[model samples]
Target: MLAGSAIVFGGVFGFVAFKNHMIKQFFATMPKPVVAVTIAKAGLTEWRAVVPAVGTLQAVNGVDISGAMSGLVKSIAFESGQDVRKGHVLVQLDTDVEMGDLRSAQAELALARTSYDRSATLLRSNTVSVAALEKAEAELKVRQAKVAGLQAQIAKKTIAAPFDGRLGVRKVDLGQYVQPGQMVANLQDLSLMLCDFSVSQKDLGLLGIGQAVRMTTDAWPGVVFEGTVAAIEPLVDAKTGMVSVQARFPNADGNLRPGMFARIEIERPSGAPVVTVPASAVAYNLHGDAVFVVREDAGPDGKTVSKAERAVVQLGERKDGMVVIRSGISPGDVVVTSGQVKLEHGSLVSVAASDPLKTAAAGAVR
Candidate 1:
């Protein structure tokens, strides 16, 4: 009875061991699961480094047109939003009183000149004293000065444009009384636009006059306006440690306006071709930056299969959703741009139909 019991137990244990071995063999024979990923070939791109900053748009010439003297508005020669030339008469103040004073002064000056002439002739003939001739000359000079002053006063009543520009909304009506230095309207020369921005003092060495700058404003979507660095402030702000920069963009279409907020990119000169991949391909970590390079290898069945291999890369400038690979990668290398999270060293991978890098470079809808 004991021998029969032992034989039965050995048979049961052997059967369990055989079942486990068969299960392990089945899994080992099955093909490894491949992680589906999107890939792009590393390509050469002209990498131009850029310093980014936000700025406010302004005109090359801008000012607030103001009244110089207190008077009633006689006439408004310019309409709001009018494009005007330099010296264009914009507002005319009531000058009736000034004109009247000028006429009286002119009449008095005429009489004084005649008296002076008569005095000079009499003195030459010994009919008048030299002091009388000198007194007549002095009165004539005073009258002349008074007339010139009245003319200047009348001229001040006529307000004209100081430069060629577009006028903002008129602040006063025809019959409104305006005081000295009161704002009448805003005048801005829009032929050329200026963008004022600030950059950190540490980046001051990267900026220079004539460096290409690209700008965009929310008012104009997808439109990139190009300009050049116009000027850089010599002194850096002590409190903020930033340097002010101005860029000049030609506005022949009059599209750019003052006070528009803009995003600015000061582009450096193009350098030699560098290897680049889509920004998504880079895995940033505290240890280092890295990218997954896809390589081909033979499977157990001798079929070629693609696998992901992680490569440590030194990064450079990044722009337009693409990042420069300064080292550890070269052009024409296949890189996994997406689905890298599921991959490990030597993990089998299959390329997906859609490539993000190509879509980004062409700006196409994905």
Candidate 2:
């Protein structure tokens, strides 16, 4: 019975050994799984840091054209949306009454001048008393003042453009009565535009007069309007701790209008070299921002293979879809920009056929 039991045990042990050897051989022959991913080489680039803010565009010179005096509109001199120069007649109000008064005052002034001349001549010959000559002189001055006032009244009724600008729709029509301080139309100088925005007090030091600025508006997408820092408020807001900044942009084409919402970017005059990569490569999580770096290694079969290794990185500003990598990776390192989901710490990887950014753009169009 002992001999029979030994034989049975040996047979069972042999069977188990053969099965394990066959399984090992089968696994060794199979290929390792690899993930296909898009990658970009980290490169050194100028670190362009920008301070972003939102603001509203305003014409450098803009105002609601209003009337200084009330009268019936005799004629409209400019059409709606007309470009006008300084002192261009915009509206002419009826000035017949003032003109009539001016003529009467002028006739009185002529008589006063004659009387003053006669008084001076009489005083020279002692033909008139000193008091009488002085009284005649005062009367002549009063008449002259009356004539000037009437003439000014007539000029006030004829409203004209205060500056060179483009006019909005005409609010006053011919024969319509307009009151003093009432808006006749809107006038704006479109040759230059100004945008007022606020930035944190800490960034105030980064700003200066003539610093380069860039702006974009919903009205003109994909078009960048270049400008400069025109003015910086000397005082910071006590409540918000923000400093007001004004940028001036050239708008010779008149594309920018007053009150249009704008996105502004103030560029730093100086920059440092930094390592950069596509923005898609970053994986943000509770732990930290990390990127998958591609590395080459020898597989078990003595064949070279690419592997993905997670690396934590400190990020800086992002511009033009590329992000500045402040730490963790150096220039010339390959990073996975897309298809990172299938990767692990040492997962095998292969370069994808097409760029992920290009693919995404194409997909968006579709």
lDDT of 1 by residue, 1-113 (tens): 89999999999999999999999999998777899998877888767788899999999999999977889999999899999999999899999999999999999999999
Q: Which portions of model 2 show Cα errors greater than 4 Å? A: 1-33, 354-366
| TM-scores, each model vs. reference | 0.82, 0.84
Task: Candidate 1: give the clashing pairs.
Answer: none
In Å, residue 283's CA in model 1 sits off its true spot by 2.0
Note each model's CA RMSD in angstroms.
Answer: 4.9, 6.5
Q: In terms of lDDT, which candidate is strongest?
A: 1
lDDT of 2 by residue, 126-147 (tens): 9999999889999999999999
Quote model 2's TM-score.
0.84
